[model samples]
Target: MPHLTIVANIKANADKVDLVKSELLKLIDPTVAEPGCVQYDLHQDNDDPAHFLFYENWESRELWQMHSNSNHVKALAAATEDAIEELSIYEMTKVH
Candidate 1:
């Protein structure tokens, strides 16, 4: 497993920013503790309100896939479908 960070840029700044932010917070604990996941965090950019970053640390790529297939993940996606313009995921490992 490695560390994963996902950044998503929303399509449009919406009225539900607070709601979406809350939803993201709700998913953090469960997602981080999920199999293979070491940590999961959500970040908001004050300079760009439409930009969100998800910081995730996983045990392995395989387990990450399992999380991606989870129901909550789906719900998150569905909840933000209209707001997302693009999504990017980065994989990294500690060298130190």
Candidate 2:
């Protein structure tokens, strides 16, 4: 089976960029240590500090789902509830 790839785009509220970023940063360490996690990387747009993106690879969609429902992820959601302007997540498999 093909590995799962996740592309998450996050846009922070104008005044909450720093808070959102810090909360997002908290996910990396724990997520990387989760089962089936192959890669977990986070990035901020060079021209737009309020924009952030996450590139992730998982061994399977099921395992990724587990990670998604973990406590840490939930905390992130709660912490940034009102601080985020937009959030988009795309689940895909590599074609090449």
* Highest-TM-score candidate: 2
What tens-digit string does per-residue lDDT give for candidate 1 at 1-96?
A: 335544334323466677577667778777867877777767888887766787767777788888889989899888877666556776667766
Clashes of each: 3, 0
Candidate 2 clashes: the total is 0
| Candidate 2: regions farther than 4 A off | none
Q: Local error of candidate 2 at 76, Å? A: 0.3
List per-prediction Cα lDDT, in the order shown.
0.70, 0.97
- What does the lDDT read for residue 50 in candidate 1? 61
TM-score for each model? 0.76, 0.98
Candidate 2 per-residue lDDT over residues 38-89, each given as its tens digit = 9999999999999999999999999999999999999999999999999999
